[model samples]
Target chain A: DAGITQSPRHKVTETGTPVTLRCHQTENHRYMYWYRQDPGHGLRLIHYSYGVKDTDKGEVSDGYSVSRSKTEDFLLTLESATSSQTSVYFCAISESFRAEGYTFGSGTRLTVV
Target chain B: AQSVTQLDSQVPVFEEAPVELRCNYSSSVSVYLFWYVQYPNQGLQLLLKYLSGSTLVKGINGFEAEFNKSQTSFHLRKPSVHISDTAEYFCAVWNTGNQFYFGTGTSLTVIP
Candidate 1:
């Protein structure tokens, strides 16, 4: 929602090309997450960062990778884009896991051609 | 880890009618429940949440949810819905790690 921003709101890339989606937050929240939304699958977490340089994988991390070098930025990369990687990616930020709620960015719609 | 399951993929209702969207979760330990609504081409907005101390939770836009521990279910309800309420609804549960698990969305369509 507020304070979180995702780059490349829309992108189209050819299969086998590298794609990276960026998530930036101004809230200074320590917890950041990346999720992909797909039909019949809802939202599946790809990766998350608890702090700068501390990252962990989620349920669906096979084709995705993430890096968080700074508290304000979390980047999700697809080593080689594939047709199955096409979906809307959303970034979320929270002060803590027990925090009231997570604030999400608008999202990036990626299409693999 | 927690898992959420939404029973319906689509629910079509007439305007001003009551509606209920079903959600069931599985977790070994205690968890928090939430419902979110996403309008077309927009990010998800929180509809309501159930943490503790209350089985019935009220949320924005006249939405409410009941957490039934016995059945391990959290179902969202609205007494009377409007056209504006037509949107995709998601049910989510927060795990012990504070990670959220979501269900397949249920799209609600309000008709005249």
Candidate 2:
């Protein structure tokens, strides 16, 4: 919460438009993640980046894309916003892959109509 | 792959009463367990985590959890809960991979 920040705390976009949410961290942690929180489903991982150029898809990554061109920033993009894509998105960072837990951002509320 | 299960979706208890929120996980290998609390319209805060060594771990807000390896359970408990404890609790498991699997969450309501 102190080192990581998510921009566009709240956003409403029209359907079929592209949307990108930014997650920037001052901690310079090696691992960053994007997750969506929904009722009954909890938090589902959408994507993760391990390094500046390395990334991977998570369980619910079909409609989402992620990019990490720099060590301090990770971005999640919606190719085309859909009504079903409306959800609260959280960005988290961890210092290690196996030993440490995550520090999460405050989260962004997104709505597509 | 690892998976976390929260059996109780909602639990109601009187203030100052003891409460336990159940959490179970499945994994072939050893994993790191954690409990996170999310208040309404807020990001998750780490309640506690069990990395290794101790089976009993204490966290913020007088919350604690025990790791039962035999049952693969990490349940959160508080002897005396306050109204401020009302929030959604999530159990998470981090496997050998870079991913963290979270449970569906248990909503705890502290009644007056």
Candidate 3:
């Protein structure tokens, strides 16, 4: 099992509210990623962090922001949650080039009503 | 840029039967490939990956995949399967510079 954990295994909130998901890794990996999994759409990347404060947008990065102030912590925040934003969120960590394999967290199921 | 395709969305087979999950990818340059499995209500776990070297890469749980450079395919195969093998399997590819891509995933069900 990976040393990664995502906070709030399940959450429910109203539309237009702000939601923040936290991913913590005990391995101290350098690369962290956020992805959302939906039926038919599979899993799509939202954002990733290479280092502290170094982040970039992913294929489906709109309305979402990520921050990595420390090596073991990566936070993903939805500025304003919408019904469309409801999905399972997964946090993953990998070493440079992904030589070994990525470590994934248990995932957070977010529901926006 | 890289993209992965898992042709079979669902595959049902009897326990002890052989099975294969097809995955194809597109990339302009040489790339890395991976397979991950997710059980019901569980996190995704790494099954196998192909970074370099041999085209046939073996993973945990008696699973293996072949990376065909010419066909741009990385199909996963197992000679025999168990009921515990039922799960969602995903195929992923990564290009140079760390850009990664994943397929829609295939759900495998093993019957008793």
TM-score of each: 0.96, 0.95, 0.96
DockQ of every model listed?
0.69, 0.67, 0.61
Output the better candidate (2/3) by lDDT.
Answer: 2
Order the candidates by lDDT, highest first — what do you get?
Answer: 2, 1, 3
- Cα lDDT of model 2 by residue, A1-113, tens digit: 79999989999999999999999999989999999998888899999988998999899999899999999999999999999999999999988775356888999999999
Candidates by DockQ, descending order:
1, 2, 3
lDDT of 2 at B100: 81
Question: With candidate 1 superimposed using the best TM-score fit, by how many Å does residue A77's alpha carbon deviate from the native?
Answer: 0.8
Per-residue lDDT of B11-72 in model 1, one digit per residue for the tens? 99999999999999887478889999999877788899988988999999999999999889
Residues B15-89 of candidate 3: C-alpha lDDT, one tens digit per residue = 999999999988747788999999998888889999889999999999999999889999999999999999999
Kindly indicate the candidate among 1 and 2 with the higher lDDT: 2
Top-DockQ candidate index: 1
- The C-alpha lDDT values of all candidates are 0.92, 0.93, 0.91
Clashes of each: 1, 0, 0
Worst 10 residues of 3 chain B by lDDT: B93-102
Mark the 10 consecutive residues where model 1 chain B has the least summed lDDT. B92-101
lDDT of 3 by residue, A1-113 (tens): 46999998999999999999999999978999999999877789999998999999999999999999999999999999999999999999987646355788999999999
